[model samples]
Target: MRDFHLLIDVGNTFLKWGLFQPSAAGGARENRLESGHALLEEIPALPAQFAKYPAPSRIVISNVAGTRVRAATIRVLEVWPDAPAPYWLVPQAEQCGVKNSYRNPAQLGADRWAALIGARWLLGPRAAMVVVCGTATTIDFLSADGVFKGGTIMPGVGLMLRSLHEGTAALPDQGGEFDEYPTQTVDAIASGCQHAQAGAIERMYAHEASHVRDLTCLVSGGAARAVTPRLAIPFQYHENLVLEGLYRVSMSL
Candidate 1:
């Protein structure tokens, strides 16, 4: 059996991973063979699935989940027989041809750093905004030349809903439909959350538009779809951006 390259992204509430196999032409092995995600609770089951395949030729990960999840992930990594050492990705001032703008690049989330790298690498010389709307919605800007200009972050759909419910006296923390005109309190809460997320994205996108022409907004993360539909600015969704970024980093090294 052909050996594989594994890519992992550990987010706040979920773990995302992708497997890449060698390509037919065998130049870059860029084609992703499989990918999946699991919420924090389901992570332990995640690594065990690796046994079905040959040991990965290499493993790379970008983790933002805190210590508990990291510890659990370590347990799973141990499951791969004779697997290569795992490469934990961190944000550097420059890597994979993307330049980071943070005063201290290491402070940026590894997931975001990967997304920026993946986005720029995928859409070379095309200026765009990278928005990841998961537990926290992050809006980062990329110049056409592959320079990462830092952006903003805010509460995502679920977090927005939770904050309102937890901060207030009566609103329940539950899912609701996004509506133009909500007749019920639940829909009102949901719609409000959507509006908040979409508005922040649009604002950042508009700011980017002010500086660049024909800007494309590249969005990802669990809540991305929920928030994208409500956005006034158009956006392209990339579910495996972080994973793709990890892949790119691996190729570079």
Candidate 2:
């Protein structure tokens, strides 16, 4: 019998879902589908996205919010009423063939867990740095030995911009394209935010390299496209690392 997998990544602002059929090698199925929602309330509609495909035998979720986590659980149960309760992928000692390297493994963010798992799969067993820029920008370093060394978290592009406006008196609420170089104050704020994030990751990449060589940087998250082009170093973007990790976890069990 074929195995069906459902992967869900619930972030601060969005919930990303990926559906796949397990192949013989325990990798993703050939016909994969991806979708997402902005509101947590819309979670109940999740099953509709996979209605055309086969029902998933296993479900994996990585949720950041407790309330949303509860909501997601309910939604999944409602959708797969007949299936077993979905597995919540928390930061554990071992998962998806990767061992947790943190001192307190449980403290590691689920999103980070997904990134490390996806990074190992994408960059092989080599030392790698994964940068996820979204609601918050996180730069995680995975040693050459496949151990997750640690990572840094900072205000993301949108959060930084919103904070500047809310916290400051002179700065106005401004927005611009992240692709173009800034010419004016608004553009400057936009570019500054983008460059600052990209610069931080570049510096982190360099810092990680002082101890480990041949480090591969993998960038992902919603704001990945905005900051990726500004970085001085070469990196690969995985738009759905969390979702991909969830899929991998489902295959494991």
The lDDT for every candidate, in the order shown, is: 0.84, 0.77
Best by lDDT: 1
Give the TM-scores of the predictions, in the order they appear: 0.94, 0.89
lDDT (10s digit) by residue, model 2, range 173-250: 666665465677777788889889988998988888788878888889998887888999879877777777776777
Query: Where is model 1 poorest over a 10-residue stretch in terms of lDDT?
Result: 21-30
- The number of clashing residue pairs in model 2 is 0
Model 2 lDDT on a 0 to 1 scale: 0.77
Model 2 spans with C-alpha error above 4 angstroms = 1-3, 24-31, 47-54, 178-183
Q: What's the lDDT for candidate 1?
A: 0.84
Q: How close to the true structure is residue 70 of candidate 1, measured as C-alpha lDDT?
A: 81
> Cα lDDT for residue 35, model 2?
52
Error of 1 at 140 (Å): 0.1
